[model samples]
Target: MGSDGTTAEVRCVAAVPCWVSLMAHDLDVAKAFYGPLLGWEFEPGPDRFGPYVHAVTGGEAVAGLGAASGGWGMPVAWTSYFGTESADAAADAVRERGATLAVGPLSFDAGRVAFAADPAGAVFGIWEGPLGRARRLDLLGAPVWIELRTPDPFAAALFYGEVFRWDGRDPERFEVRWEHDRVVLRAEGHSVAALAREQAGGPAGLPPHWEVSFAVEDTDAALIRAEELGGTALGPAFDSPYGRVARLQDREGGRFAVISAKP
Candidate 1:
């Protein structure tokens, strides 16, 4: 990407959220639910990690959906992948920081990837490969934001900063800031994600996890449609500085959010 983070940036820069994927118990069901909700179409993806498909929108690969393997109790959820120059080096950094490396820096047709958990046990992915397809951020049916809900936002930021080398001078480098009581990660002079403490009234005993939000034409309308598809809304849409957002779970219990600029 150029220093300004414009469309000229063809490849995903290291330390930025490059992709998001949902591992579902049944891939078809996942697709069925999201296709109508997000206006996405599916295309086959590399099968290195089981049956996988890319969720496409407007001729762009927006996200991924994969069938969970060896999974009776596996939590259906969206996982975010951060771009990296070297997955092996990033894995080592994660291990050195008292974190857990859950999966491989395994090779695939596209690139290498690994799954790791932060100190607070929030799982995320590291990818060393081409960005494959450009994402339509903040548009209809596209991912608008990624977030980490943890016990300690500062500690989470520090761990990720070291692992991703956020301070480096790479074109993909990020600027970190504390804003409105949350740690925000910005790239190309725009906010990409945030780290915040788990809210007091959130689901009790739920562990820390990275959350992804998709843009919609209407937040409440999308939320009602989610319920029709067997998904549960954590609550009604609430206003944020950016827009109105509502968290919801898929039929399989995968959590995600839908937001709209209109209130």
Candidate 2:
């Protein structure tokens, strides 16, 4: 049991994004930037990994912050973890499907985790453990959705389908509509995540990556606080069918979003 009486049961179905973690080039800057914006409180992670910090909101572990070491060469970004019954099996499936395994199906005090990149070069994770279900979208600071920005949405959908068994729209039916061209993934009839085609005339030099959005009470207020805390508002808040949304880049250049969904 956790300090909040939350059990570490795996509630999410297989292939659904269950957790979101940030790899920070500077942990201290990350704490300062996110703490005020999301009202997240930090706690030391499992004893084995000393530098890992778990982002807690309402006593629930919502996300994580870990130091990015040398040789990682990757930008500071949020990586989404999909739930799996067996990390080892998932890792094997990723390899067999032509995706590259970046890290381990190794175990820790909390659970088993492995990192991988799809054939299209978008990185993601697989997790199997007691705390795999620790995050809930209903929570104030929890991730409401994750979006994969890639140049090849069809290829990404097919790659993830083979690796994670995701049920997405048929490739033959794909169409780029609206401002954002994306395909939604569903598990057990519930929308889990999305695969988006890279937008034209957007920021240059941005690589294919997963973007995590947190649920907030007010998108406008969150964007204000983000700038005050050394982060930058990538764009003004805009209303959508789902909610008021805004994109933001942290002090360390990690990009994310905040949304206030319509009830």
lDDT of 2 by residue, 24-90 (tens): 8878889988988998888777534436778878767778888855556677888899877788988
lDDT, residue 35, model 2 = 89
Best by lDDT: 1
Model 1 TM-score?
0.89
TM-scores, one per candidate: 0.89, 0.82
Total clashing residue pairs per candidate? 0, 0
Indicate the residue-level lDDT of 226 in model 2.
91
Candidate 1 lDDT over 1-263, as tens digits, reads 22222122223556877788998999999998999999987777777678888777766667888995666568788999899889999999999999999999998766798999999889999989864433555558877788888988999999999998877544444578888688997776777789988953456346898889898999999999999988899877898766789999899989899988744
Model 1 ranges with Cα > 4 A deviation: 1-11, 70-72, 131-136, 170-173, 199-205
**Alpha-carbon RMSD to native, per candidate:** 4.9, 4.8
